[model samples]
Target chain A: MSEEVMTPETSQKVTKAPTKKVTKRDLFWAWLKWTTAVEVPVSFDRMQALAFSFSLNKILRKVYKDQPEELEAAMARHVQMFNTNCDWGSIIHGITISLEEQRAMGNEEVTPEIINSLKIGLMGPLAGIGDSVDQGIVATIPLAIFVPMALKGSILAAFIPGLIYIAWSYGWSWFLFNKGYSLGKSSVLSILHSGAIKKVIDIASIVGLYMIGCLSAAYVKFPIALQFKNSNSTVNVQKILDGMLPDLLPFALVLGMYFFIVKKGPHYLGIIIATMVLAIALTFLGIM
Target chain B: MLFKAFLVGIIYWLSMGRTAYFVSFAFRKPVVLGVFIGLVFGDVQKGLLYGATIQLLYMGGIEAGGNIPSDQGLAACIAIPAALMSNLNPSAAVALAVPFGVLGVMLNNVRRTFNSFYTTYSDKLVKEHKYRTLSYFSFLIPWATNFVLYFTPVFVATYFGSGLVKAFINAIPTWAMDGLANAGNMLPALGFALTLVVMGKKQYIPFFALGFYMYAVMGFSMLTGAVFAVCFAMISSLFKQHDDDEEDYA
Candidate 1:
């Protein structure tokens, strides 16, 4: 994993004609195009698909590097490269390269590469955190709040989340990308050795775990019930559990689902269908 | 009124139909299409609000291992608009969306079928060197057209369907009205509870109790409580590093 990054020696040389007098309009279109490209899913192995957009950026630099008048266009072209090449890979990598590339004009070339490794090490764990925060925490909480509020006729209610998330989602992406890149561009190697990445991963994991707990409560939708009526008494077993707490039955259900998945090796996609069918079938037999 | 519903459906299909799920998959984030619906129905704020609320209702709704969650996109787009358009209570709006969410699963299957054809055609196109045609058909044009086909029906139906539903409810006998009303009020909580059970993990029972107590006993909404609990857990987690690191030692 610490092997040196592929460098300028092998940088794919662009032969496309110079971006013909690229303008502000070209910049917008460039951003839009790359953002859309980045939208496509890539093979898990390499967010290498980002290479396509980054390559486009390189081509832009080649064409516009000499034209100081086109510098802003080139910069927009760079950020727009993200939009088209916009996977987590590109976002993270672009920032790393942006930092390294900036520093490279007068500094060590290897600095960017070393900076990327520690940053790269952080990516998977960050993915865990990013996925949890963006997909789980930020999304679900606002959504749960938004639904009821909208039900109540508050128009401003929805935008509250948008404002919050646009900031969080875009902010985190931009922050981490730029932060990772800037750090990578500098000392590059010591960042990881500093224990900062470890601390970051540790914090993210803890948050992710708590989210799993919240996710358990928020997402799972079952409760246990054992109803018994003697000559003079009645009980809901679920009520007893509920009295103990909200998620006992839920925890049990998840355990059951997890075991079923783990032990049975249930195919992930088909498991829901199979379980739903089994539940329905059991209900038909008056067993569920 | 029916046309309005149909129009809404068309619009939703256009925006979300062709590639929303995949688009979201790209970002690994749900589209929050509810915000879009809220805006369209002259209640962007309300729509977004409702969307977030339901987001919790399906937090574990992932497509991991091919598991299709209740189609949240369809739920937000259709159910939310139905709520606004029908004058049905928002609770009723949510109630209406549940069944339709299940229907969305069926629609998603239909989409998969189309993709299969697209895939097969790609092979044939490759064999014949029909690169331009294959790429165009495989990726772009089909989704563009299907967007119209999928969204139009939904908008149209919401306008008409909610009206029809309103009519159907009015036409229902008084005796059934109480039952329906009671069911509407109880079902979501039931659904929420059921969902909690569906996605549970061992040793996480207490949090559920906290959630249940917040909603059932303390009169706090689950969202507020969940947020509180999550934050508390986060803070505790920050402080509990000794414990986690100790576990790492184990």
Candidate 2:
């Protein structure tokens, strides 16, 4: 815990120019430390990134202020380190520095447009990646396995999901952190454009989309109470069509709820409450 | 009330990761917490199973943006202890757990407001930044507040009269207990739908469909579903790669 907790060195040492030392253990611990029990997704071991960014910025800021012949080269070097280890959060952090510059230039008012853009723009991609990797795959996959075991009376079951989630989520963080710092932006973007990255994304999309569909089928409820009579035409309401469909009903219900939420936003909580109340009432009525 | 509840809450939080993790505290996985409370109160299996089931019923079901009031923490820390100690139906335990946990959330906010209340006194210290004293005061309020509020009640609940508690809950008919268990089991299913909405997308739709179909049709367990999914994805990926190679030439 002492090793993992944000030490003062992480924040302050970077303010003063420091040597760039990267280690595999540093990357490993950075991921493992941040992931211990807390479910704060999208935190990029920022202290580590912060320290690294500080050194790069301190050197670059000096060079840029001097506007030397090697200014572009210096900026390129810093940018290279950044691009290699660059994550979406670090980009935003870098952008924050840019905004501060804009402010210092005497542009007093922050534009509503910039705020809106950050919200509507950054949120979608963050939610997409977070939901896909964080909640959907990492959380869902492990919990899916470990939960039943917990139900089956295993004290050790809870740790299973905890372990798996910390491993995958933090592992990705460490990998990306080191990669971005080492590779720099140009190479990473070039890699992204070079077909290898696209293939990975494509593969991810295929698997990710399929898992979402499966989640939809497994989770959503259609409530397809049939109104039709049986072969005797005796006013029997539970018709054959109710159970015949594999996932059509379930899939539709989740989509319907999603659309409802889209249309109404947080009001759906009320709907859930109402449904729960009605369900309880029906149970009382013997019609559930 | 404060001191006992604090002890209970501490035990509850520590139980979340079963002391595996120390940062920001979370051992809310029901099975682990349940057994801990059970052993502390003396019924190993009941506490384990009770805690775990309550945990499952709300698996990954987060109420983001403050829309739904869920008592996952209370369900883990408080409800299992209350239920197991009282010899109440496990299902009844879950139902009661939610409201209690919600109560805890509400209480937590009130305590937060009290800390805000203490902020009014900060003006005198601000001139010097009284940096060391200010920092100490900040810790003292929350620690003192939570300690006094939770510790005693929890101690009382754990130490005495769990079976005496059974009598009060037993007044509710067995039919009601059955209904609660039925309802509680079904509650987990309700969350799966929301989780699906967040997770589903066009690119990987087939594997999920395949997984669900295998579960519904072939009667596979989640483990089997996961295994089949990995197998299907790998095989399909190979074929897809081959298809792309053919298309490259054509």
Using lDDT, give the best candidate's number.
Answer: 2
Residue A271 Cα positional deviation in candidate 2, in Å, after optimal superposition: 4.7
Q: What's the residue-level lDDT of A70 in candidate 1?
A: 42
Model 1 global lDDT (CA atoms, 0 to 1): 0.45
lDDT of 2 by residue, B1-250 (tens): 3444445656753432111222222245565567666776677778877877677556645333212234465556767777765666767787656445445545444444554433433333433334334333333343455554544344555455355446646676654544444445444433544544444343444565565555555554566655565566666666665223211100
Name the runs in model 1 displaced over 4 angstroms. Answer: A1-88, A92-126, A144-151, A175-194, A211-227, A240-247, A258-288, B1-3, B14-56, B59-68, B80-95, B103-149, B152-250
Measured by DockQ, the strongest candidate is 2
Docking class of 2: incorrect
* Fraction of true A-B contacts recovered by candidate 2: 0.19
Per-residue alpha-carbon lDDT of candidate 1 for residues A229-249, written as tens digits (9 for 90 to 100)? 899999877677767865565
Model 1 residue A28 CA deviation (Å) reads: 8.1
Which ten-residue region of model 1 chain B has the weakest summed lDDT?
B241-250
- Per-model TM values vs. the true structure: 0.59, 0.62
Question: Lowest lDDT 10-mer window, candidate 1 chain A?
Answer: A77-86
Residue A234, model 2: Cα distance from true site in angstroms: 9.6
Q: After superposition, how far is residue A244 of candidate 2 from its true place, in Å?
A: 3.4
